[model samples]
Target: MDQSMASDLIGDLISCGNIDHAMVDGNKRPFICLELEDVSGNKLRNITLWSDYAQQLNDALGDRQNLGHVVIILQFMKHKIYKRKPAVSSMFGVTKLFINADIPDTHTFTKLLIENRGSEGDDHHVTHLTTFSSYSIKNDFLNNLQKVTINDIRDIVKPMSCVVVATVKKIEREADWWYLACVKCNHAAKQESVSEKDEYGVVVKKRSIFRCTNK
Candidate 1:
């Protein structure tokens, strides 16, 4: 079947990755990425869940990883390109998800997956699970924990992590959207002149930057 025409997916979910963020209306929103094999094909297809749906998948997957590969049935979902690759996403109110559900479709697909599946060494993406909870950021930041607004930040007396929805009226500095950071420590690094170089006639200063070894 054509990729776009295939709305329902059933197979062994390779892995569920971290819950990521995307910018929406100047606010940060959460999303999740997944990979799974479909009954019709041997290769794994990329899947994504956005907003509350991502939280729902996290909710439904509590302690299930100990059971091995999960057979997921995504019904009424939509296919789209995420980060320039073929992937699927949930359709808000329209989509329904079944995680290792005890149903006929799940059983049939499970058998096919077990029979035709090969070594998982070829699967490219290895995702880290952030947490396993059915908590939606839209409903609250943490499970039963409310999100704070920009105006609510000043009244705090103790240090705590917070989730907020705010617009970027202006950046503190121009061209500060991207920066270089140490991959190991994740600390921002600055550039400096290391040595002076004599090219042919004019002298040039060589700049060194952000090569943090945590030494």
Candidate 2:
């Protein structure tokens, strides 16, 4: 929680699914899956809105589909991996979303979007502005945490706590290793072979079976 500089995400909303319910922390909440494309870089990424923000965005959008006309600005955003996809989303009690604001970048983005839309023009530009007032910055405090290094993880003995700041330089592909898990208890499934008979009643071959003890 020592992070201070908030990550900023600016992109054009490409496609968004309908508001769906999900179980988060054992509580059912609302969310919407969104796909965004970076205008200048032309990169596609996924973004998900959860809880009240999901409802607010869905309500703001109404029946609009081409949200591409609007530029999305997520302030104080957090990075997460949802369903094995990289995502940028609002932080609870800290982040805020700004859509179609009067910012300079937004103006340029809207112009670009309009040009891309060609003669079709913009018929789905909802004039309704989206806003929320409960937003606040959490990193307003002075940073006093001691910074450490990856090498320090071993050098520093136990009972000592510090923060480590490092940039991910590379992500190497690793070998796939997935242990078979039980269906009922989710424990590792035991591997064994058992002989089975075919329709002819003769010993056909050996087969594998996954057994769940809890069931």
Candidate 3:
């Protein structure tokens, strides 16, 4: 409610999703979502950057390969419910963000990272996995690997060969939704349903389903 009452969160960037477009107030706007981890206490928080903040952060870090390694000091942050989930967000006109600074909290974070992970030269920036799909596919082979939080994987580059720990926020899925396969190859059969019986035993026809053209 007030600046003095807001909380200050210091952590390292763990996962940074792609900048996405959203319709806000009848206009298109940019927004970026990120996950941060507090190294001192091993806490995780979801962050949402909207409007100007989103644009600015994207422009600054978009080209950077190490999005996960950046240290973040969020001042005057407030906890609120967003996107049907709880998150900590920047307080407009009140919150200030510090990036990779030598502040006390940041120092503690760096020290912990170096001690636990050991410095790897200048490539110590956070390794960002752009999509969870990619991460899951690439990391499926790892067994008995140490679980590190998103913040802890700052040095993990793409095609993640090493296992890092992170909290799973939401697992998106659909019931009975799958790729249609080719009837001949049996490789995810695709079919164009000409007609189907409805619950009332009436025939109904719909648009063609997506199917492999080669089949």
Candidate 2 contains a number of clashing pairs equal to 0
**Stretches of candidate 3 above 4 Å error?**
1-5, 40-43, 66-68, 120-215
Residue 175: error of model 2 in Å?
A: 44
**Model 2 per-residue lDDT at 158:** 55
RMSD of 2: 22.1
Task: Write down the TM-score for model 1.
Answer: 0.49
Residues 56-114, candidate 1: write the lDDT tens digits. 77777675445465777888878776547787778768888888788999888777766
Sorting all predicted structures by lDDT, with the top scorer first, yields 1, 3, 2
The TM-score measured for candidate 2 stands at 0.49
- Misplaced by over 4 Å in model 1 are 1-6, 39-41, 63-65, 117-215
For residues 29-56, write the lDDT of model 2, one tens digit per residue.
7766666556554754556677777787
lDDT for 201 in candidate 1 is 50
Q: lDDT tens string, model 3, 29-135?
A: 67677777665547565676666666666676767774446777777777776546667766667777777777788887788876766663256454453532334
Q: Listing every candidate in turn, what is its Cα RMSD in Å to the true structure after a full C-alpha superposition?
A: 16.1, 22.1, 17.6
Q: Please say which candidate is ahead in lDDT: 2 or 3.
A: 3
